[model samples]
Target: MNNFKTESFDLNRAFLLDSSHPPSSIVTKLHPLNKIMAEGQIHEDIPLLVMELDNQAIAFITPQLAYQHIVQGVLNGQAWLVSFCSICNGGAVFSPLVDDEVYSFQEGGFYDAMVLLYDVQSGSYWDHLTGNCLYGSLVGKELKRLSNLLHMSLRQVLAAYPDALLALSALPEQQQTEAEEDEAWRKASEPEWSKGLVKTLGVEDNRLPRLNMGLGVWTETTRRYYPVAQLYAMNNVLIDMVDGQRLITYIDPLSGTPGAFFTDASQAEWQHNILQLNNGDSMRDMVIFDANMMLKRPQRPFQLFVRWYSFALKFPNCEIYGQPVNTQG
Candidate 1:
C-alpha cells in the first residue's frame, strides 16, 4: 500500500482507480416534492438520502443520484453534497464547506472499492464514506457530515414530510430509465456476480461475507458493525457499548431500516418499530427524552447503514457485534 499521510487520513494509492465520470456532474438544483410527485417522475419505493432542516425535508432519489455520483446544492441556506456509491450501497450527505469556503466536487476516482471525490476548488481527493481528504492540498481536512442524514424510502419520507423538496433527475427520460435498469441489475446480481468489484478491493477481510449488509456505528475513538441478519435473529433490538457509550441498535419493522441511538436505559425491546424502553417511556423512533427541555439532544448516533465490505474496508479492526473481540495488539 502506498501511503499519503494527512492530518486526518492516510490514503493508499494501491487500489485507487479513475472513475468514468467527469467532475461535478450534478450540482445545486432542487424541485419541490409535490411538483416532482405530481409529474410522476419518482419511484416511491426507492430509498433516498434524506435530511430535514427546520422541519423541511430534503431528499435525493437514488435513480437520479446513481447516475450523477455526486449532487451538490444549497438547502436552508447551507451547502450540501449528497453522494451515492452503487458499488458499496452507501450514501452520505456531507457539508461542502472546507475552511469556511464552499467547495464543489467531481468524480475524482475510487479507493478501496469505494468512490473518491475531489474538491473542484483545491483539486484534493476525499473518501466519500468518511468525508476525509486523503490526497491533495486539502489532505487532513474533512467535510463536516450531517449526523442526521437518513436513508429512507420516498414513501416513508413523504409520510413524514409531505412538503419535502426533491432532487430529481435532470437527465432525459430515456437515460433515467436506463440508469434505473442498471441499478436493478446491480442489486439482483449476487455474490458471484460481484467478483469483479471484489477483485478491485485489495486485501480482503473474510471475517464476514463481503456483501453482508449492516449498520456501522462510529465515533472518533471506535467503531462497530451490526450485521442485518444477526439483528433479525436477536429480535431486531440490541443494547450494546460503543466508544464507551451505552446505546441501542435496532431495525424498524415499518421501513426495515436500521437505526442506532444513545441511551441511558439498561435494555429495550421492540415490536413493529415501537421501542419499549426499560424506563416508563416508549419511543416510536430514535428520539429519547431530552435531559433538559430547553436543550435538544441528538436523536441518533453517527452511523451508516452500509454493506459489510464497505464498512470493513473503510474501518479496519472495527468490532463486529455478537462476535468476540480481536485481542491482537
Candidate 2:
C-alpha cells in the first residue's frame, strides 16, 4: 500500500557504456556450458542478478560489479544499473534513466549511513534504495525499477535459461582487472561494528545483531524484516502475513539470499529439498514462483534483500521475525 508514483522515466540516453573502455558484446561466443564452468571457478555460491532481454539472458553480474555501479548495455538500447552496497549488503537493479537522460552512476561516498550515487549526467547524488535524486539538476526525480530480476545463483540462472548470454565475458580486459582490484579492496575493509562502522541516526532495534543479513519488505503502512538465520532455521521457507498480504519467502540454503512472492496457495511442501506446489509443480532453484507455478516470473509483493542494520536504519519501525517471544507467566 506504499503510495508512490510509478511513472516511467524518459530514456534520453539509450546506453551508458564506459567511454575509455567500451564493453565488447560477445553474444556469438556465449554458451551456457562454457560460462557455467568459468563461474564455478570463481564461486558457485555467489549470486548474480539475471535479466532477460530480447529473448537473450544477461548473466554473470557479480556483487563486485554491482558495488562498483557498473552500467552495462543490453538489448534494445536499454542500460541496467547493478547496484550493491558492501557495507549494508543492499543489492538492487534499476533502469539508469532519470528524466529524459540516461545517467551513469558511480559510488558517491556515503550520506546518513547510506550509499550515495553520483550520476555523470548531472553530477547529482541519489539514494540507492529510494532512487531519489538528492542533489543537482534532477533533484527529487526517481529512477524506474525493472521487474522480473532473478537474483539467484549463476548455476540456477543457466539452468533456467540455457541460452542466456554471458555479459561479463564481454567486458574489456582492463575493466575486468580493475573489477578484481576493487573487490580486493572491499574485502580488506570489512566493517567493524565494534568500532562504530555502521551508524544509525535515529532510534535502534536490539532484536538481532547489527551486521546480520535481513530480507526487508515495505508496504505503505508497514515494514517487515526476515533475518537470514531465522529463515534457514525455518527450513528455508517462511509463509507469513504482512499488511494483510500472504507472502512466501524462500532463502537459498547455499547462497542465503531471500526472494519472496505473494501466493494464496498453501505452504509448499519440500521433497529432497525441492519445493513442490499443490498443483504438481516443482522448483529446484531459488527464483520466485508465481501463482501459475512459473519460475523467474515473480508475482506481486516483491521483497528487498539487505543487511539487518540497514533495514533498521532506514525503517526503524520494521517488525523483526524470529525474535524470541516472552513466555514467562
Candidate 1 residue spans exceeding 4 A from truth: 1-21, 25-29, 38-41, 53-56, 189-196, 283-298
**TM per prediction:** 0.81, 0.72
**How many residue pairs clash (N, CA or C atoms closer than 3 angstroms) in each of the candidate models, in the order given?**
3, 2
> Deviation in angstroms for 198 in model 2?
4.1
The ten-residue window of minimal lDDT in model 2 covers 9-18
Model 2 alpha-carbon miss at residue 54, Å: 7.3
Give the best candidate by TM-score: 1
C-alpha local distance difference test of each model? 0.71, 0.59
Please report how far candidate 2 places residue 220 from its true position, in Å. Answer: 4.9
Please provide, for model 1 over 121-179, each residue's C-alpha lDDT reduced to its tens digit, 9 standing for 90 to 100.
77778888778887778766778876356777666666657688887657788878878
lDDT of 1: 0.71
